[model samples]
Target chain A: MVIKVENLTKRYGDLIALDNFNLEVNHGEIFGLLGPNGSGKTTAINCILSLLKYDKGTVKIYNKPMAPDAYDIKEKIGLVMQNVAVFEELTVYENVDYFCGLYIKNKKLRLKLVEEAIDFVGISYYKDFYPKMLSGGLLRRLNIACGIAHQPKLIIFDEPTVAVDPQSRINILEGIQKLNKAGATIIYTSHYMEEVEQICTRIGIMDKGRIIAIGTKEELKDMISSGEKITVELFSMDNKILEDIKGLPHIVSAEYRDNSLIVRSSKGKNNLVSVLDYLKSNDIDFGRIYSEPPTLNDVFLEITGKELRD
Target chain B: MFLHNYIYRLKCIIRDKEFLFWTLLFPIILATLFNFAFSNITEAEKFTRLNIAVVDNEEFRQNTALQRAIKAAANSSGDKDQEGLFNIRYTSKEEGDKLLEDREIEGYIYLDNGIKLVVKESGLSQSIIKGFMDHFMQLSSTLETIIRKDPQSMERGILDKAEAAINYLKEVAPSKSSPDIVVNYFYNLIAMACMYGGFWGLKEVTVIQANLSSQGARINIAPIHKFKIFIVCVLAAVTVQLFEILLLLAYLALVLKISFGNQIGYIIFTCIVGTITGVTFGAFVASVVKKGEGVKIGILIGSSMTMSFLAGMMYDKMKYIISTKVPVIGYLNPANLITDCFYSLYYYGINTRFFINIGVLCVFIVFFSLCTYLILRRQKYASL
Candidate 1:
């Protein structure tokens, strides 16, 4: 295991930030901790990094206990915070060089690593620019370059794409994948289910300081009974038709609004076919029809009874 | 590693324009304004010999002792180096009256049973003349009493002895340098500049504590020990602060022509110590306050300004007031101690007082550093 947080618990006065939180990230998997804004994702990351004091339990990295003074363990870990953390006084190249120097002592090797990190983030053109002179997207890229310049064995990105523009967000996600391919284990945290679904090999859905579910995206989708959602555009639909569609086999719920009949069904291979057959049998006039596999949001909603973004 | 961190830290501090403006340019500008405001008063304070007349009556002529004293005073006026107390003109009583009334002389001295001084009004020059006459009369009276009690005592060279005693009683300055009261303001300005170094110290602490800033968090996550980074950052702060102080000192001495005495080595030493104290004080404040960086900075600035004010940066007499009335505060305040170091150097040369001030400043540095360490040693924060 690259990171093993067992029964970790932390409290801020009466509020529990992490309650018996347990997570084990393997050597080469992109483990995503998915949660909403205040779901204790950051608190758990801080605890795991030994940047914060936990009320109970332990965090181990690379089979060694984590601590504030654990230099050996810390040497192999890189952290890109949710907020941009580069020095405003330093230029892009200088900022990267300063942070990289912390880990790599050799002047020649540090220089090369800083240049590569800046290029990796696609910010080499703005190397001479100070952080304040850069746009928001470029500043975030500079922050990433500073964090990843030393090329540690494991990297933790805590909501790195928050408030980022779409283009930069895609660029950052792709960079993480490249780092993973380069053999660094990654721990990515975010509330954006699409982001986790897009890159994360395995994800833990967190709510109220606890992981409600943890599995691969496909496995998580399978945990929920709700499966494919079928929608059919109709000129008009009576309540009788909607109730009859709801009574179909494997159909969990059905509703008609805005001249469309939307039906949610339990996991079944022929659910979409059954919904279409019922629509034709009722002689319902339909224009367009489509079906979507269950999303992470649906799995979250089914398990937690709340939206992922809540 | 230390050198690498120190170099980058130095670069960051040097590029902080707002901090540089306050720590470097502000003192220079205030010194220039002070020079403009004090130049005229300093010039007016230069002493000029007072003019007085002696009535050429038989009483004045018969008094050979008074004649010799008057001749000596007149002779001393001819010398360029030593200042003369009086300019005497011998005239008839009628001419003496005319000179006094016409304002040609400040006062007329006539030997009536003893020396009597007449002046138009009471002022510094008039008071000086009266004081001189009173001393002469008192010495003459004492000599007469001694002669009447022991007539043969004169053969023992009593007159020469009295003259030697009078010469011994003449006022002597405490130091070779001129004690310009206005120079205290410059000392206070330098003290304020030293305290401004707290800003650099504050910045160092702000950027190193994970709970304080995101940059701090990033630094905390690094493999190196946090204290190592802190030491490097403090070295950078001290280096920049010392350079700024030396630059301010040079501006005051060379550009503004303000003399802080001839003790160049001691002045630099004081600046070095003051810079360290300023930075350490800032770090102490940053560590103790559980607030945002803005609040910590505000407190540092407010505390520094208050210390400067109490040390007489705003009013010269305030330093004396604090020193005499609240002596503990005078000894405890770092600004006051730094100011006194320069003040003692200017007025007393390198004496025990100067060493005492320097010692107190060193103590302040140790105290601040210890407090900061006590507060920051936890390493891991309960919250960020």
Candidate 2:
């Protein structure tokens, strides 16, 4: 395992921030911590990074206990915080060079790494620009460059693309994938489920300061009763037709609303074809139809009630 | 790594306009204002020879003791060319009245019963003439009592003591150079400038504490030792502040024609210690105050200005009052120590008092810096 956090518990006053949170991220994989805004995703990351005090637990990185003074571990770790943390007074190049110099003391090596980081983030054009002068997207890019300039083996990105533009978000996600491909273990966290579903090799869903579920995207979806969501555009639909469609094999729910039929099915093969055949046999006319496999959002909603969002 | 941190911190501080304005431009501007406000006041206080007119009468000519006292007060320098406490003009009574009316003589003395003094205006010169007459009368009375009590001992020590009394009044001559009152403003200016170094110190502390800023959290996550980071940043800040102080000193000495005496080494040493104390004080405040950076900055400015005020930056006589009334505060205040360092060097020469001031400032620097180190040595924060 690249990073292992076992039985972590942290409390803030009367509120429990992390309740026995356990996670194990393997080498050369993108592990995403998915949750809502106050679901202890950041609290868990902070505990693992040893940035916050935990009541009970152990965080081990590279098979060694993590600590504040563990230079051997810290030197090989890169952290891109949720907020932009680059210096406002220093230019992009200088900011990158300064953070890089923390790990790489040699001036020449630091200069090279800084240049590479700026180039990797595609912010080479704004190397001389101060952070205040850059737009939000460019500033976030600079923040990433400052964090990753040293080319650490274990990188943690806490919501790297929270409010980024689409193009910049794509660049950041692609850069993260490229870094993992370059032999780094990445730990990603975000409340946006699609981003995690797109990049994460293994995922953990957290709520109320605990990881409620952890598995691959397919496994997480399978853990819930939702299989596929099929929606059809209809010209006309009767109430008896909808009840008959609900009676089909593996049909968990079927409803007709706004001149359309929506069918939610359980785990089964050819559920969409069975539903279409039942609709045709009833002489029900349908327009365009869409069949979407169960998403991470469905799994989250099924496992934790939607009321958990604050 | 230390050198790298130092260099980058220096670059950042140099680029910071707020630091530049506070530590450099503000002092220069304040000094300029002080210079303008104190111009006429200082000119008026310069030492000038006092003019006096004495009536030429039989009583004045016959009384040798009175003649000697008047001569001692007038020709204090014992030289005809140099000016003294009084420029005496012996003239008729009518002419003396005319001279007093014309403001040619500040006052006139007439020997009527014992001695009488007249003046058109009551001022320092008139007061000096009255003081001279009083001393002569007292000496004459003492001599009479000594002769009456023991005529034999009158020749032993009474005449010598009376002669010493006449010599004491003659010591107030134009021998020593007049003290410059305006230099106190610049001395306190340097003190205030040194205290401004705390702002940079506060910035350094806020940049390293995880609870303070996001940049602080980012830095805390780095592999470097926290103490090493603190040391390098403090050194860098002190260096930058010292440079700012040097620029202010140069502006005062060269541009404003303010004199800091000829003791170049002591002046530079005072600034070095003053800057260190300032930065260290700022760091101490940053560590102790659990509030935001804005609150820490407010405390630093408020306390520094208060100390500067007590050191007489606002009014010159306040320092003297504080030194006499609240001597403990005078010794404890860093601004007072700094102002006294320059004051002692210029007026009293390099002596034990100057060294004591330097020593006290060193103690303050070490005390504050040690408190900051104890608070910052921890690598992990309780809450980020």
Candidate 3:
């Protein structure tokens, strides 16, 4: 395991930021912590990195205890914070070089690594520009380059794509994947479920400072009773038809509104086909149909009885 | 690693226009303005002969002793190179009154029961005339007592001894430099500049503490020890601040033609100590205050300016007043100590007082540095 956190507890005055938080990230696994705002994702990360003092628990990296002064363990960890963290007075190249120099003492090797990190982030064209001269996306890229220039064994990215444009978000996600492919264990945190779902091999759903669920995407989805959701557009639909759809096999709920029939089913195959067959036997003509597989949102809603974003 | 951190820190500080403006350019501008405002006042302070009209009447002619004393003062025979203290125009009593009224002379001296000095107003020149007359009266009274007690004492050269005593009190240069009171303003200006070095120190501290900034958070996770980074950044801040102080010093001494004395080595040493004190003081404030960067900066500026003001940055006499009335503040205030270091160097030329100021500054530096270390030694924050 690259990171092992057990029974971690932290409090700020009266509020518990983290309670019995336990986590284990394996080598070469991209672990994602998915939560809403103020869900203790940042607090857990800070505690794991030994940047924050916790009330109780232990954090270990590579099977050794982690601490503020654990340079050996810290040497293998890279952190890209939620906020952009680069010197405004320094150019992109110098910012990267300075941070890279902190870990890699060899000047020649440091120079090579800094350049490679800048290129990896695809900001080579703006390397000579100061941070203030760059746009938000470019600045975030520089922030990432500064964190990962030394190429540590484990890289932690905390909401790296917040407020970024769609194109830059795609680029950043792809870059993170590439970094993971190069054999680095990654810990990613975000409130955006889509982001966590798209790139995370395994996801941990966090709420109120505790991990509510943790598993692969498929496993997490299987843990919930809700499955695929099918929506059919119709010219008109009555309450009788909605009731009939609800009575169908594997159908958990059915509702008709705004000239569309929406049906949610339990975990089962051919749920969509069954809904269509019912509609056809009833001689109801549908204009359009959409069948979406159970998403992380559905899994969170089924488990928590609330929206993932809420 | 040290060199890399140090070099980058230096670059960041040097490129910071706000720090450079306050620590370097602002002092130069204020010094220039001080020079322009005080140039005439300094020139006017040069000693000029006081004009007086002595009543040439029966009492003055009969009192030959007073006559000879006044004549000696009017002539520059006491010191060959020095100018006479008084310019006497012998006239009748009525004419003397006219000269005083017309403001052609500072005052007029006439012997009634004794020598009496009359002036239009109280001023330096009028006060000098009064002082001279009073001294002569006291001397005459002393001589009369000596003769009455033992007339042979006069033949023993007591009169000549008294004359020699009077000459001993003549104005003399304390050192090989102009005792221009305006120079204190420049010293205070330099002290204020030194205090402004706290900005760089504050920046260094804010950048290193995880609770203060995102950059700080990023650095706390780095592989290197926190103290290593702090020391490196502080060294860089000191380097940049020292350079700025030297530049300001050069502008004041070489360009503004202000005399900070000829003790070049000691002056630079004081600058170094003062720069360290400023930076360390800033770091101490930043560490102790659990506030945002803006609030910390506000506190630093307010405290530094207050210290500078107490040290006579705004009012020249305030330093003297504080030192005399509130000696503890003079001893404790780094700005006051730094200013006094320069003042002592210029006037006393590396005396005990100069060393005392330097020593006090060293104490301040140690105290601030220790406090900052104590506060920052905690590697992990309770919150960020």
Candidate 4:
């Protein structure tokens, strides 16, 4: 295992942030920790990195227990916190070199790594510019460059694409995938479920200081009663017709709003044909219809009631 | 590996504007004020009064000899600015008691015979007048002897004596000479403003308060050892402070004539010590405040100025008072020891106390630096 956390429990006076949290990340796996805001995602990452003290738990990296004084393991681990971290005074290249130098002592090697980090983040043009002089997207890219310039085996990224433009977000996601391909174990955390669905191989949804569910995107989709979401745009919608439509078998939910009807179904077994037949038998008119499997958000809302579980 | 980080720390400090303002500029401005301008006397110039009556029943009261003497008797440096020194009351003995009881005056002087100065013995000004009167009496007795001995001049009247004194003054004129004043500094032999460096060295002090000093909190998590990090921070401070001292001393010596005699190297050495002292103090300040408190102005003011004062920066008498009341304060006062050591080299010669100043200054640097290390050591990164 690249990173293993067991029975991790952390308390701050009267508040318990992490309760018996456990996970084992294999090498080169993109492990995603998905949660709502304040669900102890950052807290868990902090404890595993020894940036916080845990009352009861064992955080091991490379089979060794992690502690604040574990410089050897810390040297090989890169943490890009939820908040962007880099020296404002230094240029992009200098910032990368400084952090990278902490691990790679060789001057020539550090210089090459720093250049690669800048190029990898698509911030090559801003290599000599200070962080303050850069735009938000460029600054975020620089933050990543500084963290990953060390090229550690285990790299943790906490909401790296936050406040970024679409282009920058795509670049960051691609860069993360490339890093994973290059044999780096990535521990990714984000509130954006779509992004997790796009990149994460295995997802872990946490709520109220506990892991509510953990699995692949498809596995998580199967766990919920809502199998798929079907949106149909009709010329007109009726109240009794929507109720009549909701009464159909395997039709988990139905709603009519803005001249459109939305139907939710569980265990997709030809519910679309059944729904079409029911609509035609009722002589209900519709223009167009579209269908998609349940997204990660639906799985998240199903497992952990979305009533502010944080 | 650490050197790269250390250099980065240096760059961070140099680029920090607020840190630069507090650590360097603040102290230099205060130092300039202390050195170039200061008020020595205050509160003592506020005044009370002196009441007295002059009388001579002797027939010579109208004599020119006594009249000339009376004018001369009132002659004093302060008396030259008329309406000052005394409020003369020409009254008889009968009014003396009434004036005293009515609180018209604190004392009464009945100048009968030679001169009898009477007082209520309740006020402080009485002693001042008494002292002045006693001194006047001795001079008058001497004058009488001179007059009696020169029987020929006595016939020519008191103006003749006055002329004679003026003639004597003209014959023996006070002369001016450029004395060789060699200066020897005790602590900072180089006359460096190293103490000024502490102001800038404490720039990282802002980091402790809030990460607002910078958007990123990378230094807190950087891989360098805490002590080594602190040392690097101080080195950056020293770089700035040393640059300042070099400029200051060079200007003071080449342009302003703050002579260091032949001990220029010694002055520089001591200045380096002062810089170390300043940087160490800066670290301590950084440890406590997380931002410079305008270069420890309250301490720099209280310590430096008082040191300058006790070391004759203000007045020599103040040195006596400080040495009497607080010896440690005097010894620890860098300016006091420095000026005294230099003054010894300038006016007298190098003494054992000079080395003592240098040694104590070194001790201050060591102690302050250790304090800075201990403080920086306590800062742990618990993701806090």
Q: Model 4: how far is B164 from its true place, Å?
A: 11
Task: DockQ each candidate and list the results.
Answer: 0.69, 0.56, 0.74, 0.27
* Fnat of every candidate, listed in order: 0.82, 0.67, 0.86, 0.39
lDDT score for residue A220 of model 1: 94
Residue B178 displacement in candidate 4 (angstroms): 11
lDDT for residue B289 in candidate 3, whole number 0-100: 90
For model 2 chain B, give the 10-residue run with minimal summed lDDT: B168-177
For model 3, what share of native contacts is present? 0.86
Error of model 3, residue A102, in angstroms: 0.7
**Best lDDT among the predictions, by candidate number:** 3
lDDT of 3 by residue, B215-309 (tens): 89888888888778889988999999999999999998889998888999999999999999999999999999988888988998899889989
The sequence of per-residue lDDT tens digits that candidate 2 reaches over residues B1-384 is: 888889999998888998789888999999999888887996685578788888989998988877777776666555554555778899989999999889898888887776889888777777877787787778789888978999987768876667655433444522222378789888998999999999999999988888788888888888988888999999999999999999999989898888887788989999999999999999999998999878888999999999999999888899999988989999999999999999888877689999999999999999999999998876656677
Output the better candidate (1/2) by lDDT: 1
lDDT of 1 by residue, B1-384 (tens): 999999999999999999999899999999999999988987797788889999888899999877876666655644577676778898987888899899999999887786787788889889988887777788889999999999887999887677654434666788778878888889889998999999999999889988988988888888888767878888999999999999999888988888888899999999999999999999999889898878987898899899999999888889889988989999989999999999889888999999998888989899988888777767789999
Candidate 1 docking quality: incorrect, acceptable, medium or high: medium
By lDDT, the candidates rank as 3, 1, 2, 4
Q: State which candidate, 2 or 3, has the greater lDDT.
A: 3
Off by over 4 Å in 1: B47-76, B79-168
DockQ of 4: 0.27
Interface RMSD of each: 0.7, 1.2, 0.7, 3.7
